[model samples]
Every structure is written in structure tokens, then in C-alpha cells.
Target: MTYCVGMVLEKGLVLMSDTRTNSGVDNISVFRKMFTWQVPGERIITLMTAGNLATTQAVISQLEERTKEPDERDNILLKSPTMFQVATEIGRLMRGIISERQDANGVKGRGRFTASIIVAGQIKGMEPRLFMVYPEGNFIEASLDTPFFQIGETKYGRPIILRGYDRQMSLEDAAKLLMVSFDSTLKANLSVGLPLDLQVIERDTYEAGHQHRIGHDDSYFAAISDGWGDALKNAFHSLPDYSFYRPDD
Candidate 1:
């Protein structure tokens, strides 16, 4: 299991993903779930993945290979003229892999080769965009009505983003908001452990502006975790006390 989020903002895009994967309580390990490809001033695409590790890794490796060997181009990430095309090609690759695996294994392999992906980036002369691609190879884009996407262990942290996300917030603030959300999830689920990879793509820059890893010992993340816990306690206490025995009763 993992936790990954991609947010769209007026300023640009923010992406974060945890690095933990486990077969069980005793077999936990860390593997990077975020991958970025860029053409500097032309385009920058970031993808965060969750689900079957092998499925995700194979998809990523194929995409990377296309970059190195342009002659094998069916649909290269850099060759795509728009972000939509980039996502379509990725979906095609992922779907093909899952389908091939399932077909080879027959009925028992139905859900075994599943995965999900969040794609976020900007192409020259266009507004930054964000997408959540499903295991079925279909995807939905982020817009004013839906300005963010999260894949993997999402339920635990979704409320925080729902309450705090602002379309006009700075990239810095968006990162902070996601940190709190991830902290909440981290506390609730042992499967989604740190360190987390965070990246910010500022609109029109066509490149990642900020990239970081927040480890277990990172002071800033520690502070945010502690502070959020304390703040929640204070907020809960601040609400008016409920009275079972009221005068009207």
C-alpha cells in the first residue's frame, strides 16, 4: 500500500508520494513511487503510482526506455504534443501490461495485476494539468470542480485535503497542506510509511521547481505532525460542550 497525491492550483501543480511497500507486517521495504521526465523549457511530466509494484515498475521502465531509444516510439512521453496525449499513451502501456498478464494467467489473475497512477505536468503555452488514471486505462482530468487527485490508501487523508485545499493557494502552502494530510494517514496506517517524495511544478516553468524527501527524522515534518495533533485537540475542546440535561428538556 502507499499514499500519493497530485494537486492542481492557479500557481501550478504539487505532487507527493510515500515510499513504503510491504508484503506483510514483517516484510516492509522502501521503493520510490514518483518518476519525472522533463524537457526543461518545453515540458515536465511527473507520475506517482500505486497498486501492484511489478505492474507499476514495468510501466515506468518502458516509458523510460522510450526516452532513450527514440526508434522504438509507439508513443513516447516527450514526443507527445500535449499533456492529454502523454496520459493517453501511458494508459495504453499500463493497460496492455495488465491485460497481457491477466490473459496469460486466466481467471485467477483478474485483480492481481492492477495499478493506479496520478499524472501531473505542464506543456509549453498551456495551463498545467493533473490526471488520475485508473487500472482500466481510463483517466479523469482535474478542473476547478475537481482540483486534485489521490491514489492509494486515500481514504485516511482525503478529509484534510477536502477541508483545506484552495485553488489559489501558493505552491508552498499546497505542500504544507499535503504534509498535514499525509501525516494524518501515516499515523492511521502503518503501510503508508515515510520518507515521502514531494515535487512542485510551477506554471509555465515547464520544469520541477522544488523537489524534496521528508524522512522520519525530518524536523519540519515532525513539527507539522505534532502541531497538527495538538491543533486538532484544541479545536475539539473549543467546541461548546454538549448538555444532555437542558432547561427545555
Candidate 2:
């Protein structure tokens, strides 16, 4: 399992993903879950993937290869005139790949090749956008009502985002919020171990403002984790005590 989030804000986009893959408790490894392509000042796209490692890697590889081959049909980087179209293309690719794998394996029920992705970026003349692509090649864009999307082992971290997210918050605050969410997930689930990848894209810049890999020993993340735990505990204690002593009966 993995955890990945893509958030759309008034400022731009913030994306994060963990890099752990495991077949069993005894077998574990780290593989990058974040991928990016940029055309200098023209456009920048970032993708974070979750679910079956083979399926996700295959999709990313095909997209990368298409970018390199000028004659390839409607590759992710070339054919999409808008961020929406880019997401559509990726969804189509993911569905096609999973279907082919399922057919080859003669599998029934949900196929083992299921996966999802978060696609976030901006084009030269368009507003920044973020999307969550499902296994069936369908997707939903982030809107004012819902300014963020998360994929993969998400439940453990969602509450933090729900309580803390602010569309107008500065990128620095957004990053800190994500760190708290990720720290909570890491503490609760062994499958979501770290060496996280994060990207911040400022609106209209068509370039990534910050891209970083946070390892287990990153001091800032450590501080955020420790501080968030203390803060939450303190808040819990400060809440007004329940009126259980009121003897109405």
C-alpha cells in the first residue's frame, strides 16, 4: 500500500507521496511514487501513484516513453492542451493497461492491476489544476467545494487534512499540514513507510517552485511530527470536561 495526496489551492498545487512497496512483512522496498515532467517555462506536470506497483510503474513507463518518441500517439506531454485533457489521457492509459493485464491473466473479480493516480500541474495559458484518476479511466477535478484529492492508504491521514486544510493558506503552511498527515499515517501503518517526495508548484509559474525528498531522518519533518503530537494532546486536555456528572435521572 501507499499514500499520496494532491491539493489545489489558490496559490498553486502541493503534491506528496510515500515510496514504500511490500509483498509481505518480510519483503519490502522503496520505489519512487512521484513523477514529473516540465518544459522549462511552458508547462509542468506532476503525478503521484498508488496501488499495484507493477501496474503503476507500467503506466508511468508508457507515458515516459511516449514523451521521448516524437511519433507516438497523443502522449501525456504532447497531446493534452489542458490539464483536464492530460488527466483524461492518463486515466485512459491506466484503464487500458489494467484491462490488458487482467485479460492476459484470465482473472475474475477485481483485477490485481488496479491503481489510481493524482495528476496536478499547469499549462502556459491556463489555471493550475488537480485531478484524481480512478482505475476505470474516470476522474474528478478539485473544485472550490473540495480543494484536494487523496489516493491510497488515505484514511489514516484524512482527518488531519479535513480539520486543517485552508485553500488560501500559504504553501509553507500547506506543506506543514501534509507533514502532520503523513506522520500520522507512518505511525499507524507499517505499509506506508517513508522517504517521501513532495512538490510545490506556484500558480501561473508553469514551473515547480520546490521539489524535495524527505527521508526518515529529516529534521524538519521530525520536529513537525513531535510538535503535532504534543499540540493534539494538549488540545485534548484543554477541551471542556464532559458534563457526565449532571444527574438528570
Candidate 3:
């Protein structure tokens, strides 16, 4: 499992994903779940995936193949004229893979091969957009009413984002908000461990804005982990003490 989030802000977009994957308590490995594509000054597209590793890798590989194949100018991501079209194409492709897996297996209940994706980026003339694509190939875009999306083991972290996210906030502030959410998720879930990927795409630039990989030893993240814990404890203690009869009294 993983935790991936993408936020749409007045300034642009912010996305982050954790790198841990596990089959059981003892079987664990690290694999990047964030991938990005940029066509210089034309577009910058980023994808963060969560769920079955094989399905996500296959979807990514097919998209990459379309880019590298000479005869295929049909790379939907590189060639799409609008960000909406890009999201649609990705949904189609993702749905196609899951359907193919289900059909091939002949026995399908919940369908073991499942994955969800968060897509974010912009084309030169278009505003930045963010989307969450579910295993069924359907998606919902971030809107003014809901300015962000999350996938994979998302419950533990969602409350913080819901409380703190603001469309008018700066991209830097957005990153900070997500870090808090991610840190909260990380602390509660052993399945979602560290080493995170973060990317920012400023509107209209059609270029990568800020990109970095964070590991457990990172000083800033360490500070956040410690600080959040302390803050929560302080907040809890500061609340009114329950008025109960005491044995001493």
C-alpha cells in the first residue's frame, strides 16, 4: 500500500507519493510510485500510483512506450491538446489494463489486480489540473469545493488536509500541509513507510518547478515528525480536564 496526494492551488500544483511496498510484515521493498513526463515548454505531466505494483508498472510502461516508439505520435500524454484529454486517455488506458487482467484470469471477484492514480500537470495555455483515477478507470477532478485528491491508504492522513488546505495558499504552504498529512499517515500505518517523492508544477511554465526525494533521515521531515507529535500531545492536554470524582477528594 502507499499514500499519494495531489493538490491544485492558485499558484499551480503539488504532488507527493511514498515509496514503500509490502506483501507482509517481513516482505518489504522500495519502489518509486511517482513518475513524470515533460515536453519542454509544451507540457509537464506527473503521475502518482498506489495499489498493485504490476498493474501500475504496466500502465506506465505502455505510456512510455508510446513516447519512444517512432511511428507512435499517438502518445496521449505527449500529444494531447488539453489536460482534460490527457486525463481521459489515461483513464481509458488504465481501465483497459484492469479489464484485460480480469478477462484473462476468468475468475474475477474484487479483481486482485487493482491500482489507483493521481494525475497532475498543465499544458502551455491551460490551468493546472489534478485528478484521482480509481481502479475502475473513472476519475474526479479537483474543484473549488474540493481542491485536492489522495490515493492509497489515505484514511490516516486525509483529516489533516481537509482541515488545512486552502486554494489561496502558496505552493510552498501546500507542500508543508501535505507533509503533515503524509507524516501522520506514516506514523499510523506500517504498510506506508518513508522515502517520499514530491513535485511541483507552476502554471503556464510547462516545466518542472520543484522536484525532490525525501528519505527518513532528512532533517526537515524529522523535525516535522517530532513537532507534530508534540503539538498533538500539547493540544490534547490543553483541553479541559474531565470533571470526575477523585478518591483523594
- TM-scores of the candidates in the order shown: 0.94, 0.94, 0.91
Tens digits of per-residue lDDT, candidate 2, 54-151, equal 88888987776654666654456655799888888889889989999998999765768899999999999999988899999999988998999988
Instruction: Write candidate 1's Cα lDDT for 1-249 as tens digits.
Output: 999999999899999999999998899999999999898999999999999999999898887674566776553778889989988988998999899888888835448889999999999998898988887899999989999999999999999899999999989999999999999999999999999999999999998799999997899999999899889999889999889999888
lDDT of each: 0.91, 0.89, 0.88
Enumerate clash totals for all models, in the order shown: 0, 0, 0
Candidate number that wins on TM-score, 1 or 3: 1
Cand. 3 TM to true fold: 0.91
- Tell me, by lDDT, which candidate is best: 1
RMSD of 3: 3.0
RMSD in Å for candidate 1, one decimal? Answer: 2.0
- The 10-residue segment of model 2 with minimum total lDDT is 66-75
